[model samples]
Target: MDVPVLETERLIMRSFRAEDFGPMSAFFADERSFYYGGPLSAGDAWRRLAAYAGHWVLNGYGEWALEEKESGAFVGFCGPWKPGDMPEPEIAWALLPEHYGKGFAFEAARRALRHVYETLNWPTVMSLIEPGNAASIRLAERLGATAERKMEIYGREAVVYRHLPPDLLKEQFA
Candidate 1:
């Protein structure tokens, strides 16, 4: 299954490329990566990237490498994610510190949600956010998601934010 390229006003959501490793690894190395289970070595980052690519092959739908349209820079990734271990499909995203507060994440995520509902035909999706990660919580709320419950995932507690269903999403955003 080929990773479909998705475009937004400021981003190109596509498959992970080798060049994305540098920026990805840098993000993982920084303290900002705490919420992402990062502060990992470059090798770990490479493995993560490989997983992102392989996910498309296995799941037919997975995270996309987010690229800035104008600069063509690797910004981050956002899209549908459901590894075998996960409880359910999720809309996931992670961006570099430089791209934070720029509405890039919001733009990419809204597009991803549309893909999930309109393209993938999923009834609903959830964003698993770490507790106290105010930014993610705010973004989820901004996208009209509501907190559903708390659960332990990957050995950490996470607050699950359920996004609006297809009909509701269309009504709200239309």
Candidate 2:
């Protein structure tokens, strides 16, 4: 599947490339990656990155590499990501710890959610956030998602934040 490029005022969401592996390796090894299921070794990082790349082929849409347009750096990934083990399609993202607190996650996610609802026309999308992850919980809330319930994913309990359909969001986004 051909991944479409998405542009925001401050970011360019695009496909993963070969060079992304190095930074991903570093990202996975960092302690900040805990909430993102990291602290993984280089090999595990490869599998994770490879999974993102392959998801496009299998599902037609998957996670995207978030690039800072001004600095041209790979900040993280944000978009449709469903590994088939989850309860539903998820709109998820993760940024390097240094890039946190700047609203980039929300900015990139708004665009992704718009595409999911407006373009793909999916009924609903969920963000599976770790319960202790206050930052992500806040981001989900800012995106108009409400806490639905608790569930297990990857052996850990997570908060399933449910996002309303795009029509309710259209006015605010417009």
Candidate 3:
């Protein structure tokens, strides 16, 4: 699959590379990764990285590796995701704790949402956020998404936040 690269003012959203595993593994090993299905072993991290790549091959779209342009550092990932068990595709994001307060996730998510609506022609998108994950919930809200319902994902409870379509999002800024 050919993963298209995207860019924002401070980030280069591109395809995952083998070099990304180091930072990805570190993020997954930290407690901060709890909400993202982590505190995982290095092997698991590798598998997760491979899964993202595979998702692109099978689904035509998947998460992008977030790279900070200035320092060329790997920050996190954000994009459309839908595993077999998910009810629908969702705009998802995860960032290293060190990069948390910098607005990278929000920037990446907004761009990814636009890609879904504009490029992928998806009518709408949702974010399945874990209940206790206040930060992610806030980010979803910030992206003009509102809670639609609660559901279980792989046995864990998640709140489904539905995002406004591109037209509505444009009106919001207008």
Give the top-scoring candidate (lDDT). 3
Off by over 4 Å in 2: none
Expressed as tens digits, the lDDT of each residue in 62-111 for candidate 2 is: 98999999999989999998888877899999998779888899999999
Using lDDT as the yardstick, the better of models 2 and 3 is 3
Q: Which 10-residue span in candidate 1 carries the lowest summed lDDT?
A: 165-174
lDDT, candidate 3, 48-139, per-residue tens: 99999899999999999999999999999999999987779998999988898999999999889889988999998999999999999999
The local lDDT score (0 to 100) that residue 127 gets in candidate 3 is 93
Compared with the true structure, model 3 gives a TM-score of: 0.98
Per-residue lDDT of candidate 1, residues 95-174 (tens digit): 99998999998999999999998999998899999987899999999999999999999899999999999888888778
For residue 140, model 1's alpha carbon misses the true position, in angstroms, by 0.3
Between prediction 1 and prediction 3, the one with superior lDDT is: 3
Q: Give me the runs in candidate 1 sitting further than 4 Å from their true place.
A: none
